[model samples]
Target chain A: MKLRKSEDSENEVELNMTPMIDVVFLLIIFFMVVSELSTLNLEEIELPLADESEVLKSEKLDARHIICNVREDGTIRIQGNSYKKEQLADYLKVEADAEEREPANPSNPAVPPSKLYLTIRAHKDTKFENVQNVFDACSQNGIYKTRVMATKDE
Target chain B: MIARLLRRRPRSRSSRPKAVEEAKLELTPMIDCVFLLLIFFMCNLEFVKQDGLIKAFLPKDRGQSTGPSVTDLGEVRVKLLWCAPGTTIETEDRDVGEVVLKIEKNVYPRSGATPDWEMLYLDLVKMRDIRDRSGNPDALPVIIDARPLVPHAAVVGALNACVKARIKDVTFAAPERPF
Candidate 1:
């Protein structure tokens, strides 16, 4: 009797999953880093639409921009913490001082104190006085770069 | 003689059985976790960052009066009047009833009657364009006087109209009178 060849009897194709898994893992890491960096702590609210509103392209360059939110009920929140107008002013003063003392760059230590930008995100129905109060706080602390957040009109 | 020589060759002392084949990596669980993370991030990603910004200059003096009788100032004034719904009871979260936009002698929607923001926008664009053609500075200041009872949305709508006309210098009048 003739001996049957074992290798010829079991000629099956197999897929190599190593490269696919490596690509999937790379994509996962990329998304994780982007989501963490872009997350905003403020609550989402209905912002007013503006025809002439300009896009903020320099947000990534500046790390000292202050973000404040005003709810529909006229309450102000900063970094997820509620604050009365008086307390908010005090808080802004401390932030302004801290920003003034921080160096623009570690390598270039001779730069002047960079101006702090205050970004106010208020609901469409939020009282104007609520925004004005935050404005008052910024002026009192000598922080003049103020921006009101609005939706771009399509 | 050759067959006898091959059979007589002794096995070397260092010769040993080869090690078993390396274990295969489990990819099923790892691929599942990766797909889950990919979905989570895709849902949360905000591509356009739809929020825009309007730069504002707050009064440094806390809106204190400087003086009176500056009538020579040729700034255009736009007034926004808020009207409550014709109901006996008013709730804390009552919807903003109606808004009337007024510019000089002409009243929008109707003369002290109805609220129509579309008409107000058209009129504002017309006035702004006429001034621009008359060699006036493009950045003419507009004063938006809103009532104390006016909802902020109403004021923003008026502001949107002014901005649509390419008029950037906007200042809000102090809401002094009690509603």
Candidate 2:
């Protein structure tokens, strides 16, 4: 009986989680690092606001006009003219160049002409894809400054 | 030594048998893997939650545009009106007009006389010029009014034009749709 009891005690099973925990922690760290890296290359998207404050009196907003109009027939116009959907990149490049040339003021002396402001006017029925396209164009052309125009209800 | 000597009574010809048991999986390792996977997915997931994609008009300090004097300060109010296939655009202020371009029935051809593309590009360039001349390019706010039937592609084209023209501020005017 004593020998049998000793044998039974030797056969008892138990699990060790130390190595498993170590592997899990390592994996967690790996994922954390990867997620951080992935976000670095992600695009910065500005969500459209409903209750945005009015244009400030600061002098930074003193140059360049960007008017976007979305029509019912699926026609898009900047100012009065419509642009081909594909030529957005080229157009932005040209606009950015023009903005760089026109100095905001010759008398200010402190403000460089390189600053250009952008105004995006999207219609109520406009698709999100259209807005994204505009953003993409601006990013490609190095025009980071932007604003949204809204109308007040009576 | 005395115990061994006492136990050594009979010498039988028999070899010691080998002990064997079935292999078993470690539940702890699998549980740990499940937890790790859960954490990975939770961290990597990007949830995109946005209120409706309508343009919001920010408050202008000057209040609302009421009369001619307000309009003369080089405040260019560019209005976009949305319409159906054959509907004409109407505006609250008659002076603020709508530019209509018909959508061609044929597929937008890649080559032969891309009139639509040319028109859109020209309009954007012209607006840019006006905004630059206004001296306050950043404040040149453009408002867009669109109907329900308008295709989303058209709106995108408009946005692209604004970006191309270096116009940063844009707002959409939406009135509650009556059911």
In terms of TM-score, the best-performing candidate is 1
- The TM-score measured for candidate 2 stands at 0.34
Model 1 spans with C-alpha error above 4 angstroms: A1-37, A58-63, A97-114, A142-144, B1-27, B59-72, B86-97, B104-106, B110-115, B129-138, B175-179
lDDT of 2 by residue, A1-154 (tens): 9999987876767454556556666777777666665443222222223332244454355576565554433355564567655676677667778766434343333333334555565553444446545654554455545555433221
Q: Give each prediction's root-mean-square deviation over alpha carbons.
A: 10.8, 17.9
- Cα lDDT, model 1, residue B25: 47
Per-residue C-alpha lDDT of model 1 across residues B77-157, encoded as one tens digit per residue: 887665555431222333554555678655444533244556767777777777778897656668777654455666666
Error of 2 at B151 (Å): 5.4
Interface RMSD over true interface Cα atoms for each candidate: 11.5, 15.4
> So what's the TM-score on candidate 1?
0.65
Instruction: State how far residue A100 of model 1 sits from its true place (Å).
Output: 5.8
Candidate 2: where is the Cα deviation over 4 Å?
A1-16, A22-154, B1-24, B27-57, B62-79, B86-118, B130-141, B148-153, B168-179
Give the DockQ-based CAPRI class for model 2.
Answer: incorrect
